[model samples]
Target: MGKKLLVLGASGNTGQHLVKQALERDHHVTALVRDPAKIEIKHDKLSVEKCDVFNKEEMRPHLENAEVVLSCLGFPLQRKEPVPYYLQVAQVLSETMHEFGKRRVVFMHSWYTHPESRARCRGFFLKNFFLPYVIGQSLNGMRLSEEYLDSTDHLDYTCIQPAHLLDGPVTDKKFILNETDSCIADAAQEINRADVARYMLDVIDDESSYRKIRAIGVGVDVTDKAILTDDNHSYVPNCPIRISRADVARYMLDVIDDEGSYRKIRAMGIEGDDSYMAVIMEQIDEFKKVIFRN
Candidate 1:
């Protein structure tokens, strides 16, 4: 049987995939978005609600029947206002869920939010320059949110951290899972938003992943894929480490009822497999055709 799911940030890049994929798997989903029009799909099992996540009163009614809460909340690249937005959302969700006796929660975070990630940043360019200057505020908010979640004992929370996000298609490649002090190589610094969503859903009910932070990236080598550089594929960047958003959604739905993923931080990266890259390229090529209308 499909679980009742309450999805926060349902209009964002990843949330859209999550909502669509969940419905495809027969799960009843209540998607909370700031703008209802942004959700293009209409299904009887899907409920689109327009409400601020920080508003507990507005969110209380939605929590009544939800078996699980999935947060795909994100901030703009240069957003500085609402100083600690992620933390505030975490607090609101925690309070509301506790009030309604809901226990399972999954959050989408970043690899940079992990404590060991600082060392993985390596050199001055990333550690000193990029992180602090390029995405400083957003990173700070994620870190704070992570810390707050870590301190909470009542909520069964799992934070899935993905490295640089890509808008690629799902390759169905097997992911390599790791935890604690695993350094994601430069080649593995990217994963499709879809795959991250997959990991989040997979571990949803798994007790092994509860209260844990999982970091993910794609580590495949696609040096020989010619389709990546083809002229018709301008949007799909010529990169080897590609995973799709659709696949991510597929993964999440697969594990929403499993018990091994609860309270665990499972950091994931794609295994180095050339065959997988070949298949991924084919999907990307097809995806490109659809985008270019060729």
Candidate 2:
């Protein structure tokens, strides 16, 4: 009971996960990449095709009998691609799919592409400088891509807008899709790339998600609970250390023990704000001063 899948941008980070995951699910996957060597996956059920995604005629043959089309196309935040390339890709894909009578399509986007989501972004530095300047140019392309998809006909399209991407394994952190203009998650929200792939694949077979534009947020269903010890005594530290779980996690793994971090505190967010990112700069500064002081 496996379906045929055509994946665009198969060489990219999130696209690689989608390609691999689809194969794991026993789907016959055809990955179209600019460079076939970039895919690095070989399976009897998988086929790799090298083509410019903007060329509809070249892509038409690959779309033949494809039950699902998943596109994880977009450049990095630090770099910008050429003008209206996102729009061009979507347009080409749209026409090609229509010609081949293929309909199910998934286009990757970001929550920041949504106006409301961008507005809701809390930090002044993030909103005023980082987002508007560093990340804004690329985000504009994603928005245009979504718009192009919206204009297409005879397609069961789902534009998936993921929150800020974090590098990690496929997490158990649950993902939710909201069909509104609001930000999918709070300003502090960060999702693993693999989880974003998981959700995209999840919606492929789901008929209910067709024709919907949704923003995806990770860890919304997670709850914080204190684990009780065997003894009836709560282990209380000498001083109450209040730090956001995420802020502490930023220093987790090798980051905490790295020599580079020994006497320094990674300043994260500000205090007394309505943002999900609470004051961690002050706490971390004090912790370093007290523990690593000369």
Candidate 3:
């Protein structure tokens, strides 16, 4: 049974994965973008619509046709606006969905939105400076959007929050999920955008996930050598610094692929650079030993 979904921000990094994966699963997707030309894929099941997402009238027709709404909207880092680009879209979507009696909606948010999660950052630089300086406006917008969603009791909404996003293909390992505010994986700071999309679709219709905030990260364990320290001068142990965008897509699909994952945040990632380097060193050492022994 393929459901009809309306995806906002379909041209974005994560949005692209959502649109593609939904088609792979046989779901009919109406990708709403400012520029339909940005969508490169042409599929019978996928319809690209060009429209202003901030206008309720413009979104009404699409909202009426959708069984689920997935928003992967993001703001550019360099944008100097005090508010995020997606805040208005969020408002419009919420209003339109309610007017049309649509209940299922899922939003893509960052783990930084959680105060407790932000406080958990390993060092002074990341906690006190870097994150705030770089993405503070985007964070504020997401937080405000979440707050707006929370005020509405009629919409069955789930906000998928992931750690730092990475770009890459899906990995062999599964992503981890947590229902709480904090990510369950130790020192896990990044996830694939694809996995985030996968998780959103997976729980789109699950009743348990409705009105819940889920935090996700990649499942790969970070060993000691790979852990990096921040300005606080403390080693952040077992941290996989990033995950691939493809893996994020895979995790999102896996969640949709399985019913049990409903209402849980799925963390997706691969091994960090330091961990990979360590493995390479071990291999070289083994090769040296073999040559000397011979």
Global lDDT of each model?
0.72, 0.72, 0.73
- Residue-wise lDDT of candidate 1 within 71-133, one digit each (tens)? 999875543332388899999989988988988999887777654567668544557655655
Candidate 2 yields a Cα-based lDDT of 0.72
Winning candidate number (lDDT)? 3
Per-residue lDDT of candidate 3, residues 1-294 (tens digit): 999999988999999999998998899999999898899999999999998888888889999999999998886552244356656777788888888888898988887675566777764545665555556557777878888888888889888888878777655446677777645545357677777777787887789999987777776553322113233323333434334445555555655767666654534344465453454455455444433442
Q: Candidate 2, residues 10-95: lDDT per residue as tens digits?
A: 89999999888898999999998888988888899999989888887788788876889999987544334423777788888788
**What TM-score, over all chains together, does every model reach?**
0.72, 0.73, 0.73
Query: Residue 227 lDDT in model 3?
Result: 17
Q: What is the C-alpha RMSD of each candidate to the true structure, in Å?
A: 13.6, 11.3, 14.2
Which pairs clash inside model 2? none
What does the lDDT read for residue 3 in candidate 3?
99
Full candidate order by lDDT, most accurate first: 3, 1, 2
Runs with alpha carbons beyond 4 Å of true place in candidate 3: 78-84, 182-187, 222-294
lDDT accuracy of residue 28 in candidate 2: 96
Query: In candidate 1, what residue range of length 10 has the lowest lDDT sum?
Result: 224-233
The lDDT of model 3 is: 0.73
